[model samples]
Target: MDIKQRILASSCATRWFLFGLVLIGILSLISSEWLVPSIASADEQSGRYLSIWARLATTTGLVVFEVAMTTFLLAVAYLLLTPRDDRSGDVSVIEGSDVGRSLHEHLRTTESYWFKGRSARWVRDVVFPILSNRASTDQIRINLFMALPDPSNVKLMKEYADYRESIAYKGSKDTWTQEIVTTHILAAIVSAYHNASKSNFLNVCIGLSDWFPAYRVDITDGSAVMTVEDKNAPAMRYTRTSSFYSTFRADVEHTIEMGTKLPKPVSSFRNRELDATFVNEILAHAGLSGTLNGAVNEESILKKINNSGQLYG
Candidate 1:
């Protein structure tokens, strides 16, 4: 927004105007508190004209101080009485830079959240913060609907994962294949299970399905936000009252059908570290079972997530 547009924004303009009123009041109070008193206390030994002028200045300053303070109070009252902007059914065209903030704002207020998307290294960026936020709150459930890497769609899934890996900053990712993609999803499950173990509030659930959503959709009780995989398009926010929200909500219901929930991987784990034994359990849960199978080593996946970073969104 340009300076003129910013100055004309209802909230911005009102806030700035309130600020101006407070500043004026503060200046006037300073005059009355110190400057005016000094002048009003001027010595009577001085010329009569000087003393009278001092009294006049001090009196005017006092009146100005009172008026300024009264105006400031009235401005506050006006703000208090004003109605807030009505945004029911309004859809927000969220800029790319604002996606995470928009998501966080909605997530914080969500009673339940539904995230449907394919695997991408950036998935951590989307999920971990909510886990952190939930750590301090009453329990909130985050249901992750991941694209299942089954035989029917494994090739397509691999291509999708490769494309996702391509976009991350250089030296931070690998040319992904079926095993790597599976391992990455495994990492997310591990992360979720580990965090869930640490707190009662971490009600994170992971489900996998053959359905690969075209993009990412975050559905909350009150709103639904969608973003494209490449992020070339802007994010969109749909309020619960909007028709679009119903459509997306229905879509989420449909997408979740036949989904497989996490196998809970060994029933218990005490830490976040990845080891050969832990990796075997993760694969066995995914039905790969016994040894590394085709999956990359736990060390490689660990380095990819820690040093290179990002895993899914």
Candidate 2:
């Protein structure tokens, strides 16, 4: 039967069972007074049986009462302890720049970046610059989670870019379309991840999946970066940031927990596929010619950064 029917059936069964027990209990108590006198007059063996039956009935009745009372107590406790629905989403807002600053200040930090946006250009624009100017003592452990570049996601992003261009710059001669920009940012992030893997200063993990949410969270050692995507805006804003141990932090943790539980990409580190075909496609699409060939020389990358001008520190 369906859920409602099953629920009704179970309720009916429970009610009847409880009613029967209550009736039996009342009868046993009433009968005990008269039965007790008869038990003393009956043969010893019959008297023993009657005594045992009476005790069993009394014990069963007491057990049912206790179970009912305990359930009531638990229901009351749950009502008292649970948070109100109105305040469930009550996370404190933190500026995106402030979050960027926390990453800049920490010498050693742990972080996770989760996103389902086109290219995640913000990382290259905001995150990379902070890391570039870090002190010699600075180190970062990062877990980068991105939505798998499936056909549907690509189509969605392209449509979004078209809408953005129509409203933001209809007549501009900009070479960077939404698709190209998104690929570029993905390439930049991946390139940085590769370089970090070669260094003691940064440790990185990557998870690719098609089931990511359209939000971004960067959780570091002492602070968290959180934002919800606004479809109407040109970009998503970092809406909340808090201590790593705050209630907001707990919500971020839950988000991470859900993300990790999804199926990992087939060409993942877990599967020992270091140079996955998917990774190469992203780099190639971004026009990073030699990144797929493991030709990323440390000195060359440093020089490129140096030529890029003012850092964000």
Candidate 3:
């Protein structure tokens, strides 16, 4: 049956049941001598086991009253304490660490997940374990829509970096310069993809855009998790059945479409043939120089994945 029909069937006479219980409890509490005419109470209920039981209850008086009152109280308490089940398309406003948790849950699922953000550190961290999974190998496809680390946009990236650094992470007093942020953004992307290449079953897609998003969006086929820059602020959660989901999906699509794909380096990495030379070629495809910082800072992040199997931190 549907939700309404099921509700009706389950709660057929709950109101009446509550009403009767309350009335019985009140009547029993009164202990009126005239209302239950003492000895005649035995004669009033007779002839069957149930009637005999009723007579016994009548004789017992306050005991039966206590049971009725307790039953009512317990039912009310149960109703107050029970949590409702999660329904499809429900929206939950969550905050802080919950935002990271929400993204983690979405990406962990077998279904497709799309990510668009500045530095996808949370996404990268969650994706590593999934890439190592042997059970669902080659079954999952993850899309990372990242901002291109084009050297020409370094000036604009500095502005973005300043804005991002202004918001403290976990109450940290540390600071990041524009080069640090730029290298980090570049490192996070390259490290995640290079590591994923080791997985035979996982497919990682990279799409680079010149523009940076104001917020982060991690969405699956059914649910979308979005968070703003303020770590203390609440994040938004929505399902495919919502307008937010539809609009958000469309927005995700448009943003990704605007991106230029970087497939060669990822392909070469998967084939165990990726190097700084090819890395430069990949960057050049996106209008970036491989010598961005003379292959020391951001370019070196790929070596960690190659040598130690550690993600860019």
Best by TM-score: 3
Instruction: Give model 2's clash tally.
Output: 1
- Residues 1-313 of candidate 1 have per-residue lDDT tens digits of 4444544566756676667777777776777687765654564335434556657876876787678777767665455434332233357788867776667676666656666766434445455556546654655554444333332245655776767666654444346566666666555554555555555555555666765665778777787888875443478898787788888877765655557665643436544455656655555655644324445566655544555342222
Local distance difference test values of all predictions, in order: 0.59, 0.43, 0.59
lDDT of 2 at 119: 43
Error of 2 at 142 (Å): 5.2
lDDT of 2 by residue, 82-103 (tens): 3333134323444534444543
TM-score of each: 0.56, 0.38, 0.59
Candidate 1, position 281, lDDT? 58
Cand. 1 Cα-lDDT: 0.59
